[model samples]
Target: MKKDIILAGVGGQGILTIAAILGQAAIKRGWHLKQAEVHGMSQRGGDVQSHLRLSDQPIWSDLIPFGGADMILSVEPMEALRYLPYLGKEGWIIANRTPFENIAVYPDLEKIYGEITRQPNHVLIDADTIAKDVKANRAMNIVVLGAAIKHIGFSVEEISDAIRDIFNRKGEKVVEDNLRALQAGIEAK
Candidate 1:
């Protein structure tokens, strides 16, 4: 099996955390994984994106060619649209409905969402709210990651374990909170 994913969001939104979790999981599954990341002023709310490729066999490159991605999992609505050019015909877009408006004049949210809905395959989630509801407001990124878990070629248990491994150093409470955030995303509408 293979998955070519583009993960997008602004800095400080846990975009890299999501990538780390997925990368760890990929390793556990004994899959070939390659990644390329672009960080834009992450400390100051700049754009951050990563290309993650996973397959049973060796992957020749880390970058995903345009129109070749299997999924675009974005933590920001606009960021999701930014990577549309990389999505394949049947690729799915699992994106949060929230917007991290760092620009002086952000586009109309409704219009941005309109474009996202126009896609044939998509799952738009209010991950921020879901994370808050789970009492893990800081884990919103994990929530988005959880929402896209179904399309990630890994089971919830598998990803949960990866979460545990990644957050083990932080403490059990942190781990459990993140797991709750993950479940919240999975149960999101």
Candidate 2:
């Protein structure tokens, strides 16, 4: 089996962290994976995207072809819409319901969210709020990842282990908070 995923979010939202967590989990599962990142002036809060491909078999390319993605997993709502063209007909969109409005020309939230929910395969959650509730506001990315865990190819324990491994350097408190955030996201309605 294989999965083509588009990971998107604005700068400073820790999009690469998500890729790292997932990539680590992929490694634990013995899956062949390729990740291609588009920084897009990330430090300036411009669009940041990563294309991740995982397969049980050897993969050929790092790039996910147009309309070939199995899912667009985003940490920001608008960033999710920006990659809609990459999603195939049966593709799923798992995005945070929260908006990260750094620009003056940001579109209306209702319209964007309305469009997101209109899709049958979309899973929208307030990851930021969920993380905040767990007192780990910075772990919104993990919360978002947790919410989409059911959709991704990896099992929950694999990703959870990756999370512990990734945040262990920050000390036990950080790891505990992030784990709480992840659980909150998994149980999010």
Candidate 3:
């Protein structure tokens, strides 16, 4: 199996964490993984994105060419639109409904949502709200990841194990909270 995913969000949205979890999971499953990160003032709430390619076969490049991404998992809707050119015809866009509103003049959220929903395959979620509801407000990224679980080609249990492994250093509370956040995300879809 092969999956080319683009993870997008503003800085500090845990884009790297999501990539790490997916990378770890892919490694555990004996799959080949390639990732390339693009940072636009990532330390100042600017755009942060990564191209993550996973497959049972070896991947030759870390970059995903235009119109080649199988999925775009974004923590922000507007950021999701920024990578539309990388999405394949059947690619799915799993993104959060919340906007960071970092720009001086942010576009209308309804319009942003409209553009995202216009895609043939998409899952728009209020991941921040879901994360809050799960008592893990900081885990909104994971919530988006959870929402994309079905299309991720990994079982919930497998992903959960990866989460546990990744957050093990943080503490049990974090791991459990993220797990709950993940479940809430899965349920949101």
Each model's lDDT: 0.91, 0.88, 0.93
Top candidate when judged by TM-score against the true structure:
3
Q: Compare candidates 1 and 2 on TM-score and give the better one.
A: 1
Off by over 4 Å in 3: 39-42
Sequence-dependent TM-score of model 2: 0.95
- Estimate, for each residue in 1-189, the C-alpha lDDT of model 1 and write its tens digit: 899999998877888789889988999999989988765455576777899998999999889999999999999999999999999999999999999877999999999999999999999999988898889989999999988989877899989999999999999999999999999888887
Q: Give per-residue CA lDDT, model 2, range 36-83, as digits (tens).
A: 986545558788899999888999999999999999999999899999
**Segments in model 1 whose C-alpha atoms lie over 4 Å from true places:** 39-44
Ranking by TM-score: 3, 1, 2
Give residue 88's lDDT in candidate 2 (0 to 100).
84
Model 1 lowest lDDT segment of ten: 38-47
Q: For residue 6, what is the lDDT in candidate 1?
A: 96
Cα deviation at 1, candidate 2, in Å, is 0.6
Model 3, CA-based lDDT: 0.93
Ranking by lDDT: 3, 1, 2
Q: What is the TM-score of each candidate against the true structure?
A: 0.96, 0.95, 0.97
lDDT of 3 by residue, 101-122 (tens): 8789999999999999999999
| Top candidate when judged by lDDT against the true structure | 3
